[model samples]
Target: MKPIEITDIDVSYGAKKILEAITFHADAGEILGIVGPNGSGKTTLLKAMTRIVARDNGEIRLDDRDLDSLGHRELARRVAVVPQDISIGFDYSVRDVVMMGRHPYIGRFASETARDVEICDHAMHLANVAALAGASVHDISGGERQRVLIARALAQEPTILLLDEATSNLDVSHQVEILNIIRDLAGEITVVSVFHDLNLAAYYCDRLLLLKDRKVYAAGAPGAVLTRENIREIFGMEMLVKPHPLTGKPYVLPVYMHQSSAGANRRVHVVCGGGTGSDILHLLHAAGFTVTCGVLNVLDTDYGTAMHLGLPCVAEPPFHGITPESLSGLRKCLESADAVIVTAMPIGKGNLDNLRVLLDYPAKPVLFYARDHSTRMEDCTGGEAGAVLANLEARGALRVEGAEELLARLSRDGSDRD
Candidate 1:
């Protein structure tokens, strides 16, 4: 059953309606993620629920009781809110700040009891900030401080916990740590968190609320809320949604704009594997380098990346064997190109022919970016291409150190030819 509910809630700042009758609920033991682009009123919703922003209309209820009906102590005992930002106007010990969470239980004109102290200590330990307990709040890192605030909320032992972009400023590791911690607290507390990281929300949240045009555009399980069309419409950008490799959750990958080539005339064949080939194709298109590739098997990350960019890619079906016909197509692409690039993908049985095709085409200068070492070559393929690349280096095939160097040389040389 839902532990907290927002019913047609509206809030206004002077003449502006910050929230437009927003409504949603948090089920008991469920992690609900509210995700939206910046200025989408995510923080405003959190504030409205806490009664920090007086709702101009509608009602908020907690476990069947209207939030407006609850007294300060009653609300404090039931709901714990970790605001988007916490400013320590005056320096205070971490322990003292966490102890503030025990305010609802304290008797008037009385000090903290042993039980309160124990709860504070446990909260500090749970947040992994026990060592910082005695330190001043101003002296800690932003992530640490955020954890401290969360710990304080946990100490409150509320039935519902609200977090506003709690992991926004933290690094990847810390974000994961905090997310895992929130996920672990699932059965004990109904967590409603505002998340800017769509990927993280997809992985962790049981349900997601995608906000757009001042209302809930979609709300359901992460998979439902994070579809390709929903993301494009709401976020105002094109993206590829795939399943996470590890967790099987929906993964959001934003598509970027590619610059088209200045001239419509020349086709440049790119020999790319892995993700290294994507940038080259993009730059080539911007500079009007007619780009085509062969031997990149379907399901290869590089192939998928290329297809995502709308490049004319000749992809072979995935298999243990690379067909001769595919090799012929690759050779044809090479022959048609005014220039070629051999991105550092390891030579293997499936793609050794791709490297051999480059070696065979000595007429065109092949810019080999040695980004990946020979050891990265997963396909043994008799070690012939590795030797061939070394031989080509000795024989004057250009060997560049990085992608940038390759692009700089290409832009200059291609400009001169035009």
Candidate 2:
């Protein structure tokens, strides 16, 4: 199988240009993903590869042969496309629909040969659609239809498979199943897909080409292409990029509107570490409270989440105990806050100073989340942490069962303050 090279391609509708100087190569046996905001010409670029949309200028070549020079049948034999929308006017059995992929090799007046039937059957099984072979396409679910279409493309036996949002209609399990199939076939058949779900693209694609304003914004591996800065610039939205726990690939989460009028004047300071503060910070920020967190290690997950949320944070260096300067900063935040929350997090010598700060701020309304304090103490610094927590409890600090109750208490406190 040879690569499909697109060079300096330009496509326009009358005077309106959709793509310009779009250059990239779909190497043999690699999955290249196209990702960008809507109207960035993802679909148009795919159309140019299959010659479905004429390029006003530039060349698209398949194995050094110009796509324009290849006859229809020859092109179809080498390239198979699964469009984003699949609309069938007539009700056809799944097997019959898959057989359509063998059209390039069949004569107009001839019927499918035994080998064609064999290929179709194998394709259906590979797509996990063998059970649906006898069912009418109109009677199946959207996800099942998507798999059926993929089977048809597989039956084509083309060197290159182009999918435009192929998994967009499927449920979570079906999406995973389809992507698993595509990932398995990637090294044997070149797969070029456009994906709206950045995480899925990052997981499955060998390389990514990001588009913006009808031009290449970035092109490289997923890590290089899908950065916090790049996504913000291209999509005009704030997103947090984290690694997938299982695959360790880049996963993106968009920041949604969570501001609340009820919490407009409330200020809360959180003393948490070891990832326990992340959910509390998120909840407070969403509820419209001015939230600040302090004395967290620089590399802690809580610090990272606070940074992503644009919250004020007082962080010390990684692997270091809290310093006097950081403690002073934390004290300032506590002085300005109307309430304080201490999440149930494992304490060590490095963060034991945080508990001491809570004990000192006995006059302020403090909510101690003690549900997991025992478990957290058992993991680290049990003696010192348990003693300090007892001191804070004796100093009139309120005890809350969990985050939900803490939120309710905070709401009541805010009302009382008002």
Candidate 3:
């Protein structure tokens, strides 16, 4: 039987609606994650499942049992929650806090049993908080306290576990530690968690439910639900949703957007190879500049960056010299450009012609750009490349350092092609 099933639920706070038409299910022994931006009702959904808040309409079932049919104590015995963090007003011992999870089982008239103590001990050990059993909850760090909460949840021995970004308050090391523990427990206990970190969700979750504006936006495997288009549409920002190199899971990276159209209508041609041009290429494109790049081989890193950014580029096949067709394309780009910026990439025999072509544009404004003062152009073409650079600098190629300076210079120039 499925561990969780919710259908057509709606939630609201007085007059303000929070969630609408939300429906999904979690399979037994699988980790399902709910991810969405703030105010999208991620926490509220969790609360509804546990009856912390009333759902306006819908059915919620656990293992085919109606949610309303379960008594408070029965629900507590079957479901456990690890919250983001809790305010510890009283200085309770760590063991005291974990023992509370067993209250739903213990009889009201009876004393504490030996089996209860054993369960608490085992839960603490599982959560890595056994070493701090006697410490005050307030005395330990936030991370330790979070683990204590996990241990408490584990002590309940629930069939389903809920975590509301339980590790959000901890440091990276502690976050990973707790997440590792949760992942290890996935098969033994069905986990339904709210995740702020999409990358973590991608790696750990068997499936995902995406929420937007209080409604279910998408639901499926991480790769399908976390696509570039889906993220852009929901979050209202562009992002690079590529696979993580190590885990081969979808990795989301923000496409840093610059708000100003400072270089609008101005054209700049970039002469770059290797991976040196990716940053500036994105910067210029994002700032609303008419940017063009290349005479790079198709296999070059910068070529890939240009393609990814959808910039106009001229390219040739890898390991081949710049063909007549590509050189003509580069010349046309240079002719139309208001300025030119060259990056500090290695000067190889195949690309020495790139520098040679720059000498023909003496009248055009030019800048030798670098990420920093420490990065100099690698002249692999013997002194031949050196001689070409010396000649270009002699004519009027201004040496500009850093992306900001290059952008500032380009932004300041409003003149069209001379």
Alpha-carbon RMSD, each predicted model: 3.9, 3.4, 2.0
Q: Report the C-alpha lDDT of model 3 over 291-378, residue by residue, as the tens digit.
A: 9998898988889778878899999998998888888899999999988889999998898887789888888888899999999999
Worst 10 residues of 2 by lDDT: 370-379
Predicted structure 1, TM vs. truth: 0.82
Cα shift from native, residue 34, model 3 (Å): 0.8
Candidate 2 lDDT over residue span 1-418, tens digit each: 3578888999998899999999989888999999998999999999988888889999888867899999998888888888765888898999999999999999999999999999999999988999999999999988889989989999999888999999987788988889999898889899999998999999999999999999999999999999999999999988889888888899999887566765677899988877878877887898888999988988899999899889999999998889899999999999999998887777788888877887666679888765443534333775877888778778877778766788889889877876
lDDT of 3: 0.91
43, model 1: CA deviation in Å? Answer: 0.3
Q: How good is model 3 by TM-score?
A: 0.94
Evaluated with lDDT, which candidate comes out highest? 3
For 9-37, candidate 1 gives per-residue lDDT tens digits of 88888998788979898889999999998
Candidate 2 Cα errors over 4 Å, as ranges: 260-267, 286-290, 316-325, 335-339, 346-350, 359-363, 369-396, 400-418
User: TM-score for every candidate vs. truth?
Assistant: 0.82, 0.86, 0.94
Candidate 1 lDDT for residue 49? 82
Instruction: State the lDDT at 77 in candidate 2.
Output: 86
* TM-score (C-alpha) between model 2 and the true structure: 0.86
Clashes of each: 9, 0, 0
Query: What is candidate 1's CA lDDT for residue 17?
Result: 78
